[model samples]
Target: MMTTPARIRVAIQIPPSRADYAAIRRAAAQADALGADAIFNWDHFFPLGKDTSGKHFECWTMLGAWAESTSHAAIGALVSCVAYRNPDLLADMARTVDHVSDGRLILGLGAGFREWEAKEYGFEFGSPAQRVQQLGEALHRIERRMTLLNPGPVRKLPILVAADGAKALRLVARYADIWQTFAEDDAFSEKSRLLDSYCDQLQRDPATIERAVFVDGDPWTVGTRLRERGAGMFTLMTRGPDFNLDGLRRWLAWRDEHNAQASRS
Candidate 1:
């Protein structure tokens, strides 16, 4: 259903937690070298898994470093919480990273969810609706600030919004160039249809907004289903410690084969 970027893209998400920075950096470099379209890290003050007390690294700072280190992959947080910093500040930070990466930065954003992280960092973790509202407001401010910045971004920095609710999907239709969702196949298909409807109401072409999904499992099974549902970008996640990417080759192979078929068609 989408019209642009006909080739399927595969990315790697390296969780910046529970491992050494050296290991994280190596994983990112390897992903970039492996012809991955993008590399991502999550934004969290702490680990989200069972090892809640494990070590973690911040997002944007890591991105700045990755921008300088990796040669070919676009990089960013999978979804940076809008509550953590002022929108203007985040915009400036993104602009700087865009320059650092030579225009390969994706400014992924989301409504803040973790209550405890908010309390720990002294940020206001409002209700779900309130957080989505804040995200909408922040998007406006970020856009405005990007225009007002002295040097400005090297390119029109892509904004990737990760959301599932109707209000957030409405915002995605209005503001997002990329929409990343973690819903299951049925739910994702339903949400994708809802997004298309919202795009029509907003008078925007749905093809302009790329659909991205966090993916795992077999490429020919779950991957094929999501691709059929109009997902163009598949993100494979690797946590810290080992940062295993042994499964990436299979996805890359699938990506190449799929793209080849798409091109011929």
Candidate 2:
């Protein structure tokens, strides 16, 4: 397991919907230049908002573009559905992107929740428990395939598992380098404690897995409280056509201040 990262990191998830590819590309590049620690796009075939028919793009292909467009920030899908693609194929694609980004890649995975996408795409949208089981199997294959790839990853590519339930968190404890959660406030703290227990059961240091939270609204307000509850990575989400990055700037400033204070302490 990797040591705890030094500073609080801020990331942006630029939704790949309702905007042109150019606009999305520009926003990603700008966010990277402005010092976002990571940049992300979600994996979904359709629009998540009210408008069912809206512009959208695939995940990994856009990540490949992000690899060329953004030089600094790590790029990835916020959480790719393991069921959508074959595990070995996905691992190979990730390895390719890791090389494209010169190792600035974080492979985020989830059991997958969107049944509509699965049905439309002709995938087996199994029950929640079944999907979790599938995810565990795929993760094992992904890890094994990564080792077998000819060029391999540029580094031991970090695995960020977005999990909220006990079953999923168990997978996280065994496989993840970072654990991303959507639970907040008291719920967030409770889940953190639960994850700690899982790590203990596995004889893994809880500190080895960095905590990430996906948040909206005032970054400082959300981030400040979560920071105390073991969140070291904060992800702010923005949707296009106007991918407003004003919030990202504020979060970056707060991260800088927090890191500086930690260093001084």
Give lDDT per model, in order: 0.91, 0.91
Candidate 1, residue 183: Cα displacement in angstroms equals 1.0
- lDDT per residue (tens digit) for residues 137-213 in model 1: 99999999999998999989999999999999999999999999988778988898899999999899998899999
Clashes of each: 0, 0
Q: What is the C-alpha RMSD of each candidate to the true structure, in Å?
A: 1.3, 2.0
- Candidate 1 stretches with Cα past 4 Å from truth are 1-5
Q: Residue 221 in model 1: shift from native, Å?
A: 1.6
Clashing pairs in 2: none
Candidate 1, TM-score vs. the true structure? Answer: 0.97
